[model samples]
Target chain A: MAAESHPGYGMRSHRSTLLRRLLRYVLLVATALVVAFPIYITVVNALLTPQQIAARPPTLFPLHPHWGAFASAFSTGHLGIFLRNSLIVTVTITLAELVTSALAGYAFAFVRFPFRRTVFFLCIATLMIPMEVTLVPNRETIVALGWFNSFPALIVPFLASGFGTFLFRQAFLGMPGDLRDAAALDGYGHWRFMTRVVLPMNRPVIGAFAVFAFLSAWNQYLWPLVVTETNGVRTVQIGLRQLQALSIDQTNIIFAGTVLAALPIFVILVVFQKQLVRGLTAGALKG
Target chain B: MSDTRRRRRLGEAALGYVFVLPALAVFGVFVFYPLVKTFVLGFYRTPPFPNLPSHFVGLSQYGSVLTSPAFLDSLWRTVLFVLFTVPLGIALGVALALLAHQRLAGIRIFRTIFSSTVATSVAVASVIFYTLLNPEVGLLSYWLGGRGGAGILQSPTLALPAVSVVTIWQNLGFVFILMSAALQSIPDDLMDAARVDGSSMWYRFWHVTLPLLSPTVFFAVVVGTIGSFQAFGQIDLLTQGGPNNHTDVLIYSLYQQAFVFNNTGVAAVMSVLLFAILLLLTAVQFRFFERRVFYGR
Candidate 1:
């Protein structure tokens, strides 16, 4: 706007505009490089020999690419076991969270209730408490129930996320109330209305949430680390951390393992980033 | 106000609780119950699993944690880590949102690129970063500092900040996304009017944009501060609070005591401390957000 003003202002504005444009280009490229280089480095190192990796001023691009590290990491470190455990944990958690939170969100948004606000607020209150507060108590309960080192310990506790419930509830609230009334008048019961009328409309939000819940379960480290001491139950994060300990000098294998671990999540984000951003703002930023 | 309508409302209320039932039950069992048990454990001398040695020794774990050098070091480092990341994160988030708000072409690619990290787990990310930041292997160290040998993660003095930078970088996307949405919702008329009144861009941002977007910023800050306080994965993977426990955060200390050394009681005390801090911050967030937030719509 200023660039279209008076001569002096216009000249100054033009200079600044060019400067800002240059700055933006510089920053975008730089930030992207920063975001991508770690992945790139891991990929490169995964294909390089250990001695090549240890070389001072290591090769910017791997001179001769090899896949020995990847092969070894997969076979030796029980990465296969970790991947299976991760897939089972993440998939089960995602499905459970989606169903539980969706039903809960629907009831909160549409169903008539006396203490509705109180219940919703209490759920919201849970969001404020840092996960740290509950860490020890949860372990104690796990120990008490003899649920330690079990999948149920991982699955049951996080079945319905407060964040996911809020997202679905907000989406459900945005829908017209008349849709439900129309369904009811057509002889649809509550469950039928929810399934036939409400749920189909809420797919995008649910898709978004499924992505989020999966990410949460996938990225979740402390809970998995704390709860599952056995190798059979550990998540990829634990698997990767173990690699850190195992690889002291030759980091090529660790890098390969890291890349393998991050690949699935990276692909998902590249595809679903828009929905993820929208879903995040809708639930977290909005009142 | 009719009887039938009142009954319907009552039914709805019951349904609300029912809908939220699974959440409350899980949260109670997994979150609250565990939290209380941890607090109680903090006060007691831990017995052998089936009860060979146990007692209700109040405040002793707290005393021991306070006296122990490791706990103090961890607490201090966590505070420092918190100090650098929270304000810096908010600032970066706000700035990115501002940048993204420009009516420039091809900006969505930048947005997507930044947001890409959100899907990444700490394990994967840490592993990726640990290699990229390896003093010998990393590309960044050279441009950042000459010789670039013994980079930030390796130095005890620099380890926390290095970890903080990665966290800030990783989290910047979500904050930017949230704040950009908030900024976008602000009407163009307001900006035009301010410009007609000859307000500078800085004035427009400070006087107009910030007030309208404070709620989003506040939300970001609260989440950021709480997150920074509870950060564990980065330190564990990258630094291990090593080179003399320079970067050991509170959560890592808790993990060490609880799992590594089996000082469950001391770990429990520190968890309560972290919980208390979180509770205080949450209360403060509600107060600030309530008073300062502007609902433009």
Candidate 2:
């Protein structure tokens, strides 16, 4: 409305608009390059020969690419074992979290139980307690259970999550009430209706949550670092750190291990980024 | 209430308990139990051997941990780390979000690129940064006149900041994604109204957009501060809390006290302290920042 009185105020000439667009493109491109610089340099160094990486100026691009670095790093660093360990841990956690969260979420959403509200609140309250605070006691518990330096130690502590329960509860609550009522008319009980109908309907939320849980498990460093001492059960993240420490002089080999460590997660992320975005935004909204 | 109605109600309650039992079991053993155990363990000096019994030391462990110079320095450094990362991460995220909010060709590509670092784990990022700042073979160090090839991570004064840089970079994608979502939710009609009223760009942002964005920004700050406090991998891979313990944060200090030095009782006290700090900060945010948030719909 105010533009009628001062037409030129908020309006720009076509020429100036074009100039602004150009400047914006330049800025965007520059920022993108800077943001991507670390990945770029790491990849380039991973593919370069040791002598090339050790050059005084440090080769910006690999003039003669050496792909063998990956194979050797995989063999010498036991990266294959690490990757398998990570996959087993991440998949187990994802499946376990999904099942537990879905069950608890269904209870909160549909079932009429005594102390339901209290139980839900207590579960949610666990989010406030950082895992670091429980590290010592958890280690002692694992040792006592005779599960130290094993998959149980690595996976058991994180088998369930409060946040996942909250997310799934919200998802179940969002489902249409009539759907459940109709299923009830067909002699379907809680478990039958949940598995047959409700779970299928909330695939997107479950998928998104699964991706998130997987990412967190895959990227987990501290817990695995503390729990697993032997290379037999070590994760790729810890393996990379150990590789770096051992291969200090072999920069190219270390870079290769780093690339290997990051590659699977990077690919998974790009493929599931939409789910990730939705999951993250959903979290922000609830918070 | 008829007999059938009572029977149905009892069955429903039983089903609810059955459904929630597994999760409750995990939370009991791993979360709540450990929390209570840590508090109890703070009073006992446990030897390094698994078979050795922990003797009750009353409050001696807590006293020592609180009075120790190392713990005090780590506490200060943790505060500084939070201060360093949270504001800068939010600001950088906001800037990138605003920059990429334009309606233009290939804008999605730029958005994706800005958020790419979210995929890199802390270890991956730290390793990349270590090589980049390696002084002897690093490209950035070469550019910075490497002082006979010595990297930034080597200096005691720059160690914390160096680790902070890695932390900021690692968090940039997460913050950008969050802020961009918040910014996109701002209505176009409101912006048009502000512009038609002859308000400048900065004026519209400060008075209109920012007020609406306060909630998301506050969320980012809270999450970022908690994360920065718990940061371990970067410090471990980059500086190892070193160059004279300059980069030692609360979580890293707890790690050292527990595993490295086998001082379990002291570590328990520190964990309790860390837990208290997180609770206090979260409470403060909810009390103060929640008031400023604009829930316009």
| Chain A: TM-score in each model | 0.87, 0.92
Model 2 segments beyond 4 Å from truth? A1-11, B47-53
Query: What digit string (tens of lDDT, one per residue) describes model 1 on residues A1-287?
Result: 12111111223568788887788788777866765566566688789887887666767697679888888788866777888888898999999888878878888888876667887886776776666777777776788889898888777888878888877888889998688878878998667888987899988888878887887788888888888888888877899988876654657788878777887787877778666666666645554
| Cα lDDT tens digits for candidate 2, A103-141 | 999999999999999999999999999899999999989
Residue B290 CA displacement from its true place in model 1, Å = 4.6
Q: Write the per-residue lDDT of candidate 1 for residues B1-297, one digit (tens) a residue.
A: 999988877776676677678888877777667766877888987665635677789987688777888777787888788888888887877877676566556877776766666655766777667766766655566446656445778786777788888887777667777776777767777776777788888998899989888877777777788888888898888888786788888998888878887767777888888888788877987887878777666
For candidate 2, write residues B145-263 as lDDT tens digits: 85943668878888887788889999898889888878777766777788898888899889998887888898998899899989999999999898888889999989998999898
TM-score, candidate 2, is 0.95
Clashing residue pairs in candidate 1 are A112-B12, A112-B13, A113-B12, A113-B13, A114-B13, A137-B34, A137-B35, A138-B34, B47-B53
Docking class of 2: medium
Every candidate's CA RMSD: 4.5, 3.5
Provide the clash count, candidate 1.
9
Per-prediction DockQ: 0.46, 0.50
lDDT of 2 at A34: 91
